[model samples]
Target: MNWIAALPMYNVTPELAAHWRALLAHVGARLEPWLAARGDSLALIEPDEQLERFWLRDDLLLSQTCGYPLVHALSERVRVIATPAFDIDGCAHGNYRSVLVTGAHVDATTLAQCQGLRAAFNDDDSNSGMNLFRAAVAPLALGKPFFSAVLRTGGHLQSLRALAIDRSADVAAIDCVTLAFVRDRLPELADGIREIGVTQSAPGLPFIASKAVPAEVPALLADALDDAVRADPALARRLKLTGFVRRPASDYASILDIERGAIEQGYPVLA
Candidate 1:
């Protein structure tokens, strides 16, 4: 059977997808002889059904900003190959921390002054939306309640849009990477939104494969990815990828640890 790779749709567009396909094709072609030597062929699938196949076929998956839930869901079946936690940089907190805005036309000072405001969460299972967000606000809510209301918006882009369009939420926490993606792909929406503050940095997503696959698969994939990074400047620039760095399971354990700490501390921000 041909082994497949799945790409997430969150930060990807059709044009960008085409670019990725071409780049992957180059990498795949270079790796084909080796794969064929092992009686396997490589294929890249579309974001929709292909994603399902990845989950089912025990192939590899690549995603950004999809750590928490994906890991939770697939932990028993897969192992993380590599991640970019060390290289991925977030926006400076001095300028772009998450804010609590109001439809009543509240300024930063006024919003900050408000004792209790509504908050919107993209998903309870997101690292950026939950883990980093909790770490950012936990200090401030040391002895007081932070939000009067909290609503789940399903995804980051939807949460951002909900904060602007619904008039129900006073604030929403967004990831810097997602913010940049929106700025590049959906400029109009990005123009209206403002970042109030930034959260602490956490690791980004990992390229994961089924635990059943031979260990050599991950080693080979990692090598091909490193070569792709070294040879293709356009690919590196487009993905903001510095390079693939090997990560052990312990690196991701901190994410689960943060979530557990927040829950134990009775912080509703992550719940």
Candidate 2:
């Protein structure tokens, strides 16, 4: 009965927190016998902390970008229970093209004029912040440097704020999912920023479990997720989680392929 849940850092809010509690309660109620036998309790791990630890534990690990490094990181420790390629549209921060300017320093049209301008990325491990952003610029960076400089800001919100306040970056890719979340909850920032371009669609988050968990764990996790998505209409609408779609390991290989092609073509700024 030692059940654990982890969700993305960006999507955590009071309502979402309540939603998760309810979902976990449903799961716990359904697995009460197992819980009694195991003499354990259910726990919820916040996305920003303990995600790596949860992946290592014989419990469920949930988050976005369940790609190469994460899957490989957990392969020996856990088994991927159910992965939805296009699960929840957690935030509008994925592929929305935007040159977050410093109080009218540059507009979208002006930013586009500066083709080889510097940009800031959230992280190297991020698919939407780094990988998808690289792919968006790959075709345009023929022989010239697409980005004069690239800074790793560690998080999407930091990347956005860096462009607006720091003046160190010319532009930054903002994910639509994060945008949506902020627009609905934190409108001040949303009102100040504007989108200049858009990248291709990126995949959604995945749900996982430990390899040593009961064989029925995967099925139970998937069923619970499906029920949660169906039962929580308000939450679903708030997050725009259309539904869960199953995916395999090969689905994320394209990200690496994009990385390889960019490196081979000498667009190593993205790498």
Candidate 3:
């Protein structure tokens, strides 16, 4: 039988790698007991593979994915399992927001002042990294794009580096919950970044399963996630997770709406 597993959206820095492993391990361990009870075992795939490539594959029993790709990219390829509730700034229940961040020394506070500056995004398919930030800048785009150029940093951590270390970008949008973790784990790195604005809250990343997975798996996974948060003190403390909530697909429609609204407004892409 094929194995099933879980993965985060992207890799983390070396310093925080162990913490991520522990969190995923905790979730995987919590899930397996229940999965085994049903004659299904949840395996933890710890490859360095890009998550976006395998998220829709047949063996993708469970994985966390951003809302942007969930709507614009994956669509019906995966079924929603449950949304993780995180205790982070700009997050309530399972809805979370993105932060427009810049180098701590940049004196400009308003988005308009930073016009024509370089902007970096994690990926074109990211909600917090791209779409919402695009919408955030759409009003300022007018007839011209906001940044003189755009850089595809491939990951939020890369975008953070572009702003704080490389100095290649004047601004970037980061997931608030991810920021919370980085700040908690890597305070010195976090100190180099500062938020100027925040995107509207959308549903946080949802755990998804490939259509091939058992239909009853979602309910069991949800129960396991809640149990982990309530019972796994280490994981709960590290992730600041409250619980899991089942948010309808409609909860993510607003993200697509934002994308459409931006496109129709003559700002097809982030300015």
Candidate 4:
């Protein structure tokens, strides 16, 4: 239990959280049979723990983080283990996109129609929530901002709720994987979640280990990820996990380009 592990981003509902626990347990079990050979061990960080606090912990053996944060803030502090390949509707292999969704009552069906409407986003640093959506909106903004205002919901699920349930915002760009999970697991939150537009796909959230770990850890992790998916078909189904990829760090540079592309278009922020 000296090392930490978590898959916090997509656990937007209780069912998904339980699935994540199961996924972790399966991965941990795979490790237990071999980790001792390297004098290493891992354990799930309590699901209820404040996950953001573990981003830089030395004991953080495994975790998933948004691509934006991985490029913008965490590149130096962590090494990517692998990118999970989800079998969700809006994702392909290890890449995912964001959907611009509006209330079913809203007539808008395209990004242009949603112009000047209030936008809800999970966070400024979120890749699928804000950065890619910002990029999608940048070209549409010839010289004026698209959304009249922007709401900063704390996370992807919260952003989905802000538009789908609370009605606090007219629209929001939700992570496709998160949306898929909500649509399937949390029917209440998906009631009016209609997708109007989808952003360009990019590398999905990646599993990252602190750089303090051994140089060989990334390959070890990649192997374990593939093994876990192959060894436990039921667990893979629970999480909609199809497989994983050994994506190079350079593959994530596109996220920075999207952020920079938006800034260059005179619409740096979502608003």
Candidate 5:
């Protein structure tokens, strides 16, 4: 059978996208012979469909998904492979936090001061963008609307633009890795944004494979990731990747706890 793979979560710019493709190709090369021995093959094509649909495919051999969906929508259908540990300020022990950013022009220095202002988030399913932000603001909401309006920007890049360039929104919650990439590769977007606060840390995105794959596949992929980093030190540094660390699904249950905490506080949505 032919399987597929993707590393779509952090491809914030064209340069970053090319790097991720190269990394994926390298891992695929390492896995090819092993998979071929078992009469299986892996494809390095980028998924052309929506991520949720791509994740659900039976032929998905490798992919990266947010912790929010891993706990809420994908726990049973996909098997946890490993979490990539990044060498960045907001990351530690394979866990990462979201940085709350506001435009340079905005005078709100803290989250509390920004109450009732416009807000932007990448997607509701995004742990960094929505869940963490919801958890952070839930206590302040007190069962009432906090932001005057909430915009769904579809991606961190767009959310950043909504906060800095267009000024359509006053603040956004962005993944720390994405912020680092923008600072390195897309500096113009990073220029006028200010990190006002950070959300509680949780396990970063986890690599996942379809449950139908062989039991050995997860460890194989983890080894491939380590090999990929060693083989290309320059690329790994540019990607801010240190190595892959195996983490159980239970480590991600805290993400649900964050959501439940918000809902219990009557702040289910990011409003």
Candidate 6:
């Protein structure tokens, strides 16, 4: 059967997208001999489907997805492969945080001070943009809406733009990895946006394989990714990828816990 793969989570810019493509090429190269040995052949293709739909495809040999969606929407549909460990601030041992950003001119120094302002989030299903942001603001909400309005920008870059350029929103929670990419590749977009705070850390996005793939596929993919990174220290550093960590599905439950904590605080939603 033909197989497909994508690493869609952190492609924040064209340059960054190119970098991910290069990394994928290296990983695929490392996996070729091993997969051929198993009577399996792999193919790399740019995915055209919406991310969630793409993840659920039967031929989705490999991909990476957010933890919130992993627990809520994709738990049983996909098999966990491994989480990439990044040697970047706000991340450790495959865990990452959301950086709460605001326009540099905004005077609000804390969440409480930002109450009644409009907020932007990538999507309701995003762990970094929504779940973690909600969890951070829940205690300060006192069971009421914290932001006067909430805007779903559909992506972390859009959320950052909402804060930095459009000025339609006062603040946003952006994935730290996305922020890192913007700051490194497209520094201008990050120029006017300043990180005011960060949310509690959770496991980073997990690489996954189609449920139909044999259990050994995930292990093999993980080994190939490690080998690829080890072979090119420069590529690994450029991507901020330190290593890969094989984790069980249970490890992502912490993302759900962060949401539940907010719900229990009576601020079930970001609004």
Best by TM-score: 5
Q: What lDDT would candidate 3 get against the real structure?
A: 0.78
Question: Which stretches of candidate 6 lie above 4 Å from their native place?
Answer: 37-40
Per-candidate local distance difference test: 0.60, 0.58, 0.78, 0.82, 0.91, 0.87
- lDDT of residue 233 for candidate 5: 94
Q: Can you write out model 1's per-residue Cα lDDT over 59-112, one digit (the tens) per residue?
A: 543332255655576555676666642223453221122332333333444434
**Each prediction's Cα RMSD?**
4.2, 4.1, 2.1, 1.8, 1.0, 1.3
Q: Candidate 5, after superposition: displacement of residue 17 in Å?
A: 1.3
lDDT of 3 by residue, 1-271 (tens): 3556655653455545555556656667766666677676556766566666678788777778899889976888888988877777777888998988887767768777778788999998899999988888888888477788899998888888888887888888899887887787666658887778888888989988887877777786777667767776766666677788898777888899988888877899775
Scanning candidate 1 in windows of ten residues, the lowest lDDT window is 91-100
How many clashing pairs does model 4 include?
A: 0
Displacement of residue 158 (Cα, Å) in model 3 is 1.0
Task: Report the number of the highest-lDDT candidate.
Answer: 5
Instruction: Flag clash pairs in model 4.
Output: none
Off by over 4 Å in 2: 12-26, 47-50, 61-68, 71-77, 83-104, 110-114, 165-168
For each candidate in turn, the TM-score is: 0.80, 0.78, 0.91, 0.93, 0.97, 0.96
Better of 3 and 4 by TM-score: 4
Give a tens-digit lDDT track for model 2, residues 70-150: 534554455555443223243232212322332234554533454766677887666667766776676667646766688
Please tell me which model should have the higher lDDT, number 4 or number 6. Answer: 6
For model 2, the local distance difference test gives: 0.58
What number of clashing residue pairs does each candidate have, in the order they appear? 5, 16, 2, 0, 0, 0
lDDT of 5 by residue, 132-243 (tens): 9999999999999999999999999999999878989999999999998898877778997998999999999999999988888888888998899999999998789998
Please give the TM-score that candidate 6 achieves against the real structure. Answer: 0.96
Off-target runs (Cα >4 Å) in candidate 4 are: 37-40, 47-53
Q: With candidate 4 superimposed using the best TM-score fit, by how many Å does residue 197's alpha carbon deviate from the native?
A: 1.3
Per-residue lDDT of 214 in model 1: 77
